[model samples]
Target: MKSLTQGAHHIGLTVADLEKSAAFFTELLGWNEVARNEQYPAVFVSDGTVMLTLWAVKQEPSVAFDRKSNIGLHHVAIRVPEDSALDQIHQKLLAHGVEVEFAPEPLNGGPMRHMMCYEPSGIRLEFIWPGE
Candidate 1:
């Protein structure tokens, strides 16, 4: 079937701490804060190529997303230009006290290298570098 969409325009994520999550993209990753909505309490960030819309959770007792059972987003895998970037980001994540699932290593015995970790708001992120 012919697809209507060209590619991803943006991604919206529901986070427990909107400020911290926004800071993750802006402060840690050095992405720019494009816009914000006080009414919905959402922060929009962009890294020149990709944009993320972080929405704040309204109430408590919120359940965390389980990739094994949940029928939602499993994880967001971001690509880096160079292989060393994975290690660099891993170091930054560790220095900042972010939870690291694993260090940079061969991805499933493949040529690509990747590392996984949880951001401040408990969202799983994977950083991968395509070796060439």
Candidate 2:
């Protein structure tokens, strides 16, 4: 069996407001929209390479992120570039009162960096720099 079965197909994120959430990703992460709203209530976005699809959930369900109660998935990791950029984004997250799960850490030996945070509905998200 293939350990990873090729690369990630896509990432699905449930959000309160599809419009707002989609815009946030496009703005903050510079992800361009590849497809959107073909399903009436769902929005699909991409960065010309990776796809990020957002589903509008009427009532967001409890997630493991709330307390490791819900199971199956832990979080989604996002790749970034610079450590300083991660630190600055962390500051903005704090200002927004976004739930930050931990302090940023150096990844891939040292240069790469990462931080964990929760979306409004308690979905764990990891922002990282996947070093070469």
lDDT (10s digit) by residue, model 2, range 1-132: 758687777888777767777776676567787777756578888866678788887554633334356555688787766667688778877886778988688766676778899766566789887654
Cα deviation of 122, candidate 1, in Å:
0.5
Whole-model alpha-carbon lDDT for candidate 2: 0.73
What TM-score does candidate 2 reach? Answer: 0.73
> What residue pairs clash in candidate 2, if any at all?
80-128
lDDT of 1 by residue, 1-132 (tens): 999888788999999999999998899888899999999999999989888999999889888999999899999988888998898899999999999999999987868999999988899999999887
Off by over 4 Å in 1: none
Report the poorest 10 consecutive residues by lDDT, candidate 1: 107-116
Clashes of each: 0, 1
Q: What is the lDDT of residue 82 in candidate 2?
A: 66
Report the number of the highest-lDDT candidate: 1
